[model samples]
Target: MIRITKELSFPLENILFSFALKSEAADVFDGHNTLITGIGKVNAAYELSKAIQHKKPSLIVNLGSAGSNYFQKGDVICCSKFIQRDMDVRGLGFEQYETPLSNLPILLEYGFEMEGLQTGICGTGDNFEMGHNTRIYNVVDMEAYALAMIAMKENIPFLCLKYISDGADDNAADDWMIQVHKAAVAYGNILNLNKNNISI
Candidate 1:
């Protein structure tokens, strides 16, 4: 009864490998479980929302890589709330990317069980935010906020779990390639423990 989605093949591939190694229910959705959607914050959101509607899972987990300021590579971030920081609706005027507050607390309550975990606002965008662009936020990624937005609208209990694959700077890409495997393992551990309800 858990549904998971990823924006790219790398993240998806890692996620699947993690699932295989960690969960007994890996074969539950053999064919229909994995949905291959190319990257893009918006596109992944739409496709994932549609998939959620179709699957109607009890829990929806979004697994991927992200850039962070305070976190080191391989750190896991279980977002208590996800937001679309790039959406400028005040001037044009509407909440373009708003996700519901799932009544979940915003602090690390299960740190003893899961190590190196942090809780903070995840700023989502359509592009990989790096360098000076990261000065305004702590962490950046392509899909979390949008996925959270859609999940809120669809009335699903969504959990945004992303592993820090890079720091927020020019060196991000290189860092990601180097740390993704370890990040994936950390993500799998987070999932296996079912820490979604533990909040931030």
Candidate 2:
């Protein structure tokens, strides 16, 4: 794991938020620690791997924008389960989205409640094109599962929040590019409700 620690120190449980794009977190957090891990599962895993090992915060939160066919734009959702959408090797008797030989199912679960947010599983991949999964209410993102998996491995309490930016479709790429900034601002304002702003 690459160590990317800040010189500043804080108490335990200091919330560390990871975002794949700055637009997703630029203003979402006031004073809490945040990082732009770039877009895609590889970048997410690589950056987050370093983050957790270096800081070792009590909790990890991944906040970002997603495109969904079922969810409407601007709706904040809690990512309760994570599935690696591209992990398919059923030909060899592995289950869909199942991590091979690791006993770690590609489907990872984390349940945490927040008001006005729907709980949904996030299907993660490096590709932005939308596709199918066993889950019904799912969010399409490029980074959530990788971050969640790392968080799980490190035994840190984790939560993922997403704001739907577009319907996953031919227009999704363009729409997401335009909507993410506004979504970030809205998410940041929502954080105001946290008061202490660092709940698990």
Candidate 3:
């Protein structure tokens, strides 16, 4: 859990910027308190839990790149709802996306909805989606669900912003490699515009 900003300042001091990878965030969020949680659900959950234990933040803002079949590339989406796409325990009489005996809902809807940004339902899974066919979620990522769950458990406000880097199809890998670098720029612009105006 590395803090990108050396000196914590006002407005952003209470806000924690969470990213799955450093490449997704780049250096655009240098002046803010950022946590590079690595990739996937386990890493994200562990790192964020450690960060919270060390210092509880008022808001946890997750910014990263994602693949989407519904959204176009270069679009910055605000994801207020999250679902674990890989959680399938239907054989045990549990609903799809439900954590068995956890009492958590199938869909976890908890995040700040940013004005002027397109809202999306983010599906988080361990594997990279190459052929997304589910209509339940419009966006697919590797970490947002775990991060959101932690925030929900801790009673911390959460905000998720995803940059559409690729379409979840055969061409996803190649497209993601090319467009992922631009995620930081798009996030920078969104945060800059909302930093002062938004409550979260």
State, as a TM-score between 0 and 1, how close model 1 is to the true structure. 0.64
Model 1: residues with Cα > 4 Å off, grouped in runs: 1-36, 89-116, 132-136, 193-200
lDDT of 1 by residue, 31-52 (tens): 3244434456757766775676
Per-residue lDDT of 112-195 in model 2, one digit per residue for the tens?
545567778888878886443345446888898888877877787777889899888788878888888876677666554243
| Lowest lDDT 10-residue stretch of candidate 3 | 1-10
Q: Quantify how close model 1 is to the true structure by its C-alpha RMSD in Å.
A: 9.5
Q: Ten-residue segment with the worst summed lDDT in candidate 1?
A: 105-114
Off by over 4 Å in 2: 1-13, 28-31, 131-137, 193-200
TM-score per candidate: 0.64, 0.83, 0.90
Per-model C-alpha lDDT, please? Answer: 0.53, 0.74, 0.87
Candidate 3 error regions (>4 Å): 1-10, 193-200
lDDT tens readout by residue for model 3, 88-193:
9999999899999898889999977777789999999999999999899999999999999999989988888999999999999999999999998888776662
Q: Per-residue lDDT for 178 in model 1?
A: 75
In terms of lDDT, the best-performing candidate is 3
Residues forming the 10-long window of minimal summed lDDT in candidate 2 = 1-10
